[model samples]
Target: MANRSAQDIRRLNRFEVLRRFHASSGPRTRQDLASETALSFATVSNLTSELIGEGVLVEAGHAQSGGGRPRALLTLNAERGTLIGVDVGETSVRTELFDLALGKMAVDERPVTPEDVTPDQIADLIEAGAGAVLAAAESPRSRVLGAGISLPGLVERERGVSTYSPYWAWRDVPMRDRLAERLELPVHLDNPLKASALAEMWFGAGRDVDNLVVVMLRSGVGAGLALDGTLYRGATNSAGEWGHSCLVFEGRRCRCGNLGCVEAYVGTAGIAETLRALAPDDPLLAQADGAAASLLTGLAARAAESDPIALAVIRRTAAYLGAALGNLVNLLNPETLVLGDQVAAHLGERLLAETRAALAGHTLAQPLRAVTLRLSSLPHDAVSRGAAALAFEGFLNDREVFGPVSRTRGVKARAEGRG
Candidate 1:
């Protein structure tokens, strides 16, 4: 401790204080910070004052949470910086702009398909979407600290490379570097499910719930695990690729070239495949002529109306989904499990109920009893929102690193509208 210089000590203290403030639900007093960060009251007060002068902290309002005199509350200067996040999903590209405090400023999305999934095409869409969102939010490029993108595939996050995306048929693309070049901004990228889990842990359903899993059910099933307060990306960053696990040996073929993987049964694509086996002559398939999109919607709509074939298909998928969840419960024993994407929007409570029933049957009684299953509170935008959060988190950790770049740009976006 004695080896540290005075400036170094103060810098670390300021980081701690500011970090505590950013994580708080609302503005907090120095006394609150002192107690929370285990720093002395005098040190907290001094650091807070310095932050106020630097325009990073502001007196938001007053509260009597500690129950003495009404202490002044402090929060980050929300207007100081911005973050952008992009989600390149199977069907669309979504972009979101957020203030330093993680509040949405503006959003944009456009439809896309597997056939249109080239790096150049996707990067152009992201660039335009970001430009539009920034202008819509009236946010300047200078205030934009950085941007993030999430892919529905394996990501070499350190290299900013998307290793592969089955749905998009994309393989080994350097998405981050390309997008950064297009947007002329610092960029970060990660798996969409991981980003979604980050958002849930940071500000959504899994907040304060350290051990949790967010299961994403789109055309395919993917799970994001947050273990002991951090995302659990395993060796090769493929920890939560539980979808590829074999559920039924040699049963149904999956796009991943495996037979009877969990995703082959529970994913939207998988459900449709299953439906084809059971009711080959069903009207939903005939009505949509076997389109994956129409099949899912038609199935869900009929299931909602208690149509027998649709209900049976859902129940069968639920059984597989629950069996997979039971493995998660027995292995990870997460505090919460969040079902999201197409599954939640379409199947809703029925999926939850059936999953619970099947999970109870597969999992040990004690662990199953302690777990909670929840529907994702995030809208369809969860992945994109999480991506933006990744950028914000990076900037906050080393604001000084990009501080000069941001300052040199002169906050022109605030004064001058989009040119």
Candidate 2:
């Protein structure tokens, strides 16, 4: 009975250590965990042993000590489990597999035409992609702890539902439950922009910063706000719908039935339409029917090389983005402003310069100096990575959620101790 009780206590301590590890900093030693968790050294040691035995924690070299042998440092084993991330965008679906350490093992992307694409199709594609990635990594599907799907719309994380996606014409979709049912895994659903912000917060530029604004200018414009180290998803999970913000008094009509919205000017369709108007004689229009992707890729390439028409389109879009960013900076005063999207990555230095110049002209010199503006490093796969990170967060929080085998082992340990 005493040994059984000790095993129970150690199991609880293991859960506590994993929970705290997600939020805490630096490599933790047994002593460090003992002090932080308010547990005795013997308890800490036993719990650490359990975690190490389960392959959840590993000795990552050692820490220096004033005297005697150095203490062994422990960290979560990133390769012990797998996480799957799905990015469901308007034009395409991207799926990625990552290890617990957050290393991307494999990625797959497929073009999605909404007219023919159904929720089932999207989910199947994600499953296939994840399976392929796992096969490539030689990892078993049973080892996948959790999966997260990032959608381009308002998402209620707790309810695991998508409230709306004007682009996809979806409403009240039970995205999480459906994916969970299909994959037989714990699933999480979130807004693509919010996922992007989370990715930045944990792994990218916003890692050390507390307050940040992540502006994603992809096929559409969206923003994610992180303040004081926590994500700010406003009432009804519609906080960062910056794309719908009114920019012009009576500008072009938006698909959302709004006039002069930022999306009307900067969305991929909007840009392509603008390009069509500017270059009526261009051959892109002739091939638009069957070669849209190639055409867009070509146009993006031309823009990167400073083509006059493409540069003009990019300049105009950047100006509008800058204007909106200035307002955001003044309102939020975030420590860092991240520009994320396909366009930002393609244009690179030129895009940054234009965005900076626009901000300089609009924002106050003092505040502008304080705010660090940069493009995202994970340009193509950021949203997908964010989804994986969400799963990683869940994995690190509770072993039962990720490591059912370990939970079973803990139970067996208790029963045997009692026996």
What are the models' TM-scores? 0.84, 0.80
Q: Which tens-of-lDDT digit does each residue in 1-419 have in candidate 2? A: 24345445445345455544544566799988777655667767876887788787899989988899899999978778889998988777898888876678888887777565667777787777777788888888898989988987788877888888887677888888888888888887888888888777766777657689988876678898887656778877788999899988898888888998887776666666666778887766665443445555776788767789878766776787788788888888888999887656655666677778888777877778789999887657888988887776555445563332111012222233321
Off by over 4 Å in 1: 1-25, 31-56, 65-70, 286-294, 401-419
Give lDDT per model, in order.
0.77, 0.74
Candidate 2 lDDT for residue 251: 83
Writing each residue's lDDT as its tens digit, candidate 1 over 1-419 gives: 34444444555455556546544578898878877656777777887887687566899888766576788889988887889989887777899998877788999998786567788888888999999999998888989988988888789877888888877667899988898888989898888778888777665676656688999898767898887655778877777988988899897888888898888888877787778888887767664432566777787788788998888888888889888888989999899999988767778888788778888888998888889988887787888888887786556444563231111001111221211
TM-score (C-alpha, index-matched) for candidate 1: 0.84
